[model samples]
Target: MTQSRPPLNAPHSTAQSAPGALPGTPLRSPADVLGTGVAFPIGVNPRGQLSMVSGERAVTQAILSLLMTARGQRVMRPEYGCRIHELVFAPGDATTLGLASYYVDEALRAWEPRIEVEQVQAQLDGQDTSRIVVDIRYRLKGNPEPRSLVFPFYRSL
Candidate 1:
């Protein structure tokens, strides 16, 4: 008898919207990355490790976008609410030390979310240098102390 309200994180299409020219309302597009004044040098390393200056930028942008969105903000309570427990990276080895730190600090700062990164450890799985993992511990609302969420956020990035 009553229609249920859509959750904050529900897809845009599912939300009630004004009528458009088409049969259905258009879906929202992905968030755009902010422009950074810095420029990156072009070229691959002799070790065969490819680097893209915007790699971390793009990732950080996405994370920020998600948090700022209506859905993300709902979950991201400012008063000791939901926070990132940890950020684990792959390639478990000697590489990715600086990269991991940069990503966690920069991205978390941009989002303005309360998350404590205990340490950035390089995990090496065999000879693969493409993957790196870092473990972090933080706290969210309804909990007195910090806990580890172990979010598998990095997927094929």
Candidate 2:
């Protein structure tokens, strides 16, 4: 009778290392694995490789992203976004502008943790009544310097 043997590529029963992990390699910390810097949006560049952004530019982008997201849009976090789009259809007047500003402030405070909101102003365009200019001033967290962004919101008459 011939004796049978296990396959050469089969995993050893006594191996101590986890599957696919190299021996003696240390595991990375959560922060190290997640990274400390911000990553740019996918396909942001022509090359298709991921990119990074930091400092003022990154903060600006973050704020824009938060403001653009509508409530109930994010999965499992229905109240995490802003309702700025709804203001576009609202009657353009002093009271409406004040309400819009209040909404913007509230949304930013709830969603963005990197900045302290200084002011949010909504102004109707002089030449184009259908457009409203939203100016947001904020101070970055742990920094005294203030940054401002002006975004245009348009609505049909």
Candidate 3:
């Protein structure tokens, strides 16, 4: 008989460590160490089970959730959201852009710890006078590759 190796993403459940790796260290899936969570705009799987997001996708979804949600939207978690929505009524000027960038930076730093924020910029959209384009550049704490996200913040004026 032979014991086949589990897939890289498969979770192991053994009291003892993996052979030849480390005496006391337990085997862990790389995906688990990265992260995992319920998918945004969540949907059911083919078998009717809830879908999930993992690794980089999970981090992206978390950041999106933090950005799109307004403070006090959650029933009991009032402080779990960003304040950029408040700028919807403010004038779309340099000061407003600065404030928007500030709000995004603050929210990401406060809510998500898996990634380190690199740069945050708020610029005017070329065709939309009432829109402020927020550009966020960040990377996972241990990874050197960078990722970026663009969020358009619109003002009533």
Candidate 4:
């Protein structure tokens, strides 16, 4: 004859809650809660001290970094950057300006998820041939107000 086993004291259903989590509450990842942050690059600020930013500010800095970096410059992620630098050598024309804007738009959409891009305008400076002005208009997530930034790139002739 076999002996009877004791009844289990565990909850009846594990599906009701996550492991180690309270009932009616679900677990969340860091990315889902805290926004992404990146340290300010060297020479970005004159303060000369390390600084980090989050939320809309972080997104803005990240956009500028991405735009400044040329594709293939980042190891192990050649496709992670935009080809904006190539615009420097390109003849300043409507088609070239449009292409630059397109590149910025594609790169932002692929990397930045915190903002909804409204418009990307790129144009060559009328007074300075070496300067290219790029204006990015976007609305940050969870924010109703729209924001914009103007990034100027100076190419060496």
Taking all chains together, each candidate's TM-score versus the true structure is: 0.30, 0.68, 0.81, 0.70
Order by lDDT, highest first: 3, 4, 2, 1
CA lDDT of every candidate: 0.40, 0.73, 0.88, 0.77
Give the alpha carbon lDDT tens digit for every residue of 39-116 in model 1: 233456566665443433444434444322332345454432122223233333343455554555454454534334
| Model 1 clashing-pair count | 12
lDDT of 2 by residue, 1-157 (tens): 9998878765455546545676544544334332344554533545665666565666677777777777889999989777777776878798777876777888989877778999999889899988878899988775687889887777554
Q: Rank the candidates by TM-score, best first.
A: 3, 4, 2, 1
Clashes of 2: 0
RMSD after Cα superposition, model 4: 7.2
Name the regions of candidate 2 deviating beyond 4 angstroms: 1-41, 44-47
Better of 3 and 4 by TM-score: 3
Q: Which candidate is the best by TM-score?
A: 3
Candidate 1 Cα errors over 4 Å, as ranges: 1-95, 112-114, 126-128, 149-157
lDDT by residue for model 4 (1-157), tens = 9997645655444455557776645555435443656565733436765566665566778888888788899999999888777777788788888988898899888877777899999988889977889899998775678999898876556
Name every residue pair that clashes in candidate 3. none
Q: What C-alpha lDDT does candidate 3 achieve relative to the native structure?
A: 0.88
Candidate 1: Cα lDDT at 76: 54
